[model samples]
Target: MKKVLFASTALIATAGVAAAEVNFSGYGRFGIGYVEDRSETTIVRGPGADGLNGTADDVLARSTAQTDDVILVSRFRLNIDGIAETDGGVRFEGRVRLQADEDASNGEANSAGLNGARFSVIYGGLRVDAGNVAGSFDNLANYYGNEVGLELFAGQYSGVDYNFLAYSSTGSGANAVFFQYSVGDFSFGASYDQAQATVIGAGGTTSTTVDADRWDISATYTFNNITAAVAYGQTDAGVAGVSDPSLTVLTLGGEWGDFSGTLFVADDATQVASTDGTAWGLSAAYNLGAATTLLFTYGDGNASADTQQVAIGAIYDLGGGASLRGGIGRNDCDSCASDTIVADFGAQFNF
Candidate 1:
């Protein structure tokens, strides 16, 4: 009986090893900041905030700051991904993420959050991806520099920083269907999504509902170091009081020796009451050496309360998946305060 049990355990272990595969890769960034002028009327809020009533003063007055200098942390994330294969050319992949300073505050570190997961199958001339992931219509545009700039035209408002028509909210995990056809450097694809919005509020309370349906199509052409693409997207909101929004974007991106840049423009078909706006952004990065790089960006929006920003930054790789980054940015707004400055420095590590 003991020999039979041992043989069964050995067989199971061998099968497990044979059926499993492992790959690990992730990136992390962390830093400290000091904003000379944090006196803005417009406030930044969490993704769950109700309206645009929150202000920078609300956050700064509550958080601890030192004299004219305040400690700030921004955009830190750690992610791990895993994949396992099954029968019939089918595969499953999952990812988990930890965000420390998503709020750009110096407070306690936030916990690990689920980024996304997906299941896929492939055959000749056809591929299907169904699960929770970034949508097809999402714009891959950089609206600002590495550290302190904001995405003015990312959403309907100057302060809103997401291209919702292009990207679905991932609170409850949206369902996405994607189809693609490829031949050489020319390819085309389309995606459709129908997902329920994540619900907040306990007991009886008023909550903002985001039941959005979206569709997107894209085509790309590539030659040498230059790649250009055009994409169109639209979203229909089922919830009342929210306007259905549609957007069209054109992007041109390329990489040359030691230099890379992306230029993007997006026009919003339906704008919010106070913010009907079109947005444009330009971002470029240049490598100075094996250890140093430079980045610059500019973004502007056409809201009645127009906003614009400029940023410049430098990063130095320190080996061992660690680096140093710093930047300065200036923001000017018509509705909010006229001008503000942001400065930050930080070190990052990954394993």
Candidate 2:
């Protein structure tokens, strides 16, 4: 009887240790909205796509159209993390992620399935990370569910929607590496990436070529409630006949009490044909209360034609890891016959 009790206690202790070694957490946002102008010609389809035409008055007049404005959903995510005991004391590590949207939307396609797997190894004063993940370099900021400044560097600055150009390496493709070091309230880092592009043009023209080599470096400083940073990046195409683009970006961001905002300016110094332009953007978010927030943004670009955009939105936390969001936006161009107005509302939850 004594032996059995001792064994049972040992098993319970082992189980508790195992549980304590693992960590889990996640967050997500869902949103929907109604646009007054759903006419194909009045909307900007995606980044780099041509725009549709509808009078600004006509678009704004229909703000109450009341359509299913579900813009973003399935924002749920999960994470599993743990640290391993190694020879150098104890190393710290973790992995967290979610499936890409294309993978979750279609049941028949597994080609775009897994998003990424990230791992980190830390020892002494050095840490190394390897994996498929998303990160922001420099002081350039990311606009959640909106647009990112890096897209302009890739020659994709159309004033339609939030779709911007992105570079990714997955499967048997290229990879990225990042390095960082910190002292006091200042930190600096740099990242490099290389990948291949599988381009399938219209009329059955499919081509596979080495994409581009990209590098970026940035520095940040913090003082009281303000933090500021700047970053520069360059991309060189490995294939002949493709344009090699180099980009420079400056970003300033800060937060105080209920206010947070980022201002960004970027220039594309690509010497290659069909890939040179300049762009800038500003975005701000303010907390209204514990459960509510407001967002505003403005952006412009000098590619193809001069284009500009403005947007405003709000989010309300609904408790239980859920929130309600809605926003209205407009896109205008110098030579276009019409403007676009976009509005949407939706709910997001996390578990």
Candidate 3:
């Protein structure tokens, strides 16, 4: 449920004083875990001939395949929203979030993990946001639904990883403008980001960076106890030797009694030559009692990068703004040719 909060002072319609309400909120989790994957090359190259780094031939290289790491991990987020209405009834809303850094390694707080800010204007069912916002695909079921084992099967998207459209508002760092409108049981949203990904080319010891942009649109319908949504996105390859990237996702979600689940299918094409990505995933939840719930999630990806994952978790409400979380899962990917084995037990706090 969305929370609406009032400002400390309730002054309204006064001399030059605007009536504004501020809402403060966020969620966090902490746990111990281990992960590893090394089926495919996890390396990225800079100034390397193989179009990859960290190999035997690269000057600077990095890879995501990790065999092991520290087990202690934590996440934190904070959001402050300012809202006010003009005398003519136009609504103005601004948000600043203190979220985790997207590229940060484990157990690090550089500059207190501050993300960016965004603002929105709303009139009736229409709303728009600018500055540090994400695209419409962020609201997809597999992206937004309950996830377990530290977001093994869900969470990050691999197919469309080049731009803000792939990450949405939650993906740490891409900034954009977002638009949305709602009428009764139907709603639509769109977003655009300039230079979300930069084209890079090695010029001897020099590298070239080109500017590009991306955009996405999504629509959703709610009927009875079900909601269905579709999102499409495209990214312009700002430089030569690159193909324009595009993605499409379809999702169906519903609740029958205490059982709720989401089924989603996605297809992605990026600027990389001769490469394709397709995925299907499902997530479900059931309440076991007043304060306990069970969750399950699974995902399978096709193409050169065949991947699959499944997880089951349980959440126990502990009252007073906290809950107990536990999950176990396994994931394997072909392109990177790696496997992730996971078991996570933690506590989450919401405000």
Which lDDT values do the candidates have, in the order given?
0.58, 0.53, 0.68
TM-scores, all models, native as reference: 0.70, 0.65, 0.79
Question: Using lDDT as the measure, what is the rank order of every candidate, best first?
Answer: 3, 1, 2
Model 2 bad stretches (over 4 Å): 1-20, 28-31, 35-73, 85-96, 100-113, 123-126, 135-174, 196-211, 239-243, 270-275, 305-307, 332-338
For candidate 1, the TM-score is 0.70
lDDT value for model 1: 0.58
Comparing 1 and 2 on lDDT, the stronger one: 1
Which candidate ranks first by TM-score, i.e. highest? Answer: 3
Candidate 3 worst ten-residue window by lDDT: 1-10
* Candidate 1: residue 251 lDDT (0-100): 68
Q: Tens digit of lDDT per residue, candidate 3, span 195-288?
A: 7343344433334456667888999999999899998988777667777778888888899988998887777675454346776778889998
Residue 228 CA displacement from its true place in model 3, Å: 0.8
Task: Using lDDT, give the best candidate's number.
Answer: 3
lDDT at residue 215 of model 2 (Cα atoms)? 71
TM-score-sorted candidate list, best first: 3, 1, 2
Clashes of each: 2, 10, 11
lDDT of 2 by residue, 177-217 (tens): 66665677777766666655454333323345566667777
Report the lDDT tens digits of candidate 1 across residue range 1-351: 999987775565447545444445556665667666433233444323333233222232233343434555645555555555666555555554544443333334565465555555545445566665455454232322222322111121233233453322224346576766667887676778875554444421343566667787877778898777777777776666767776666667788899888776767565574455676777778999979988777766776455566778777889998878777777676677457776677776667
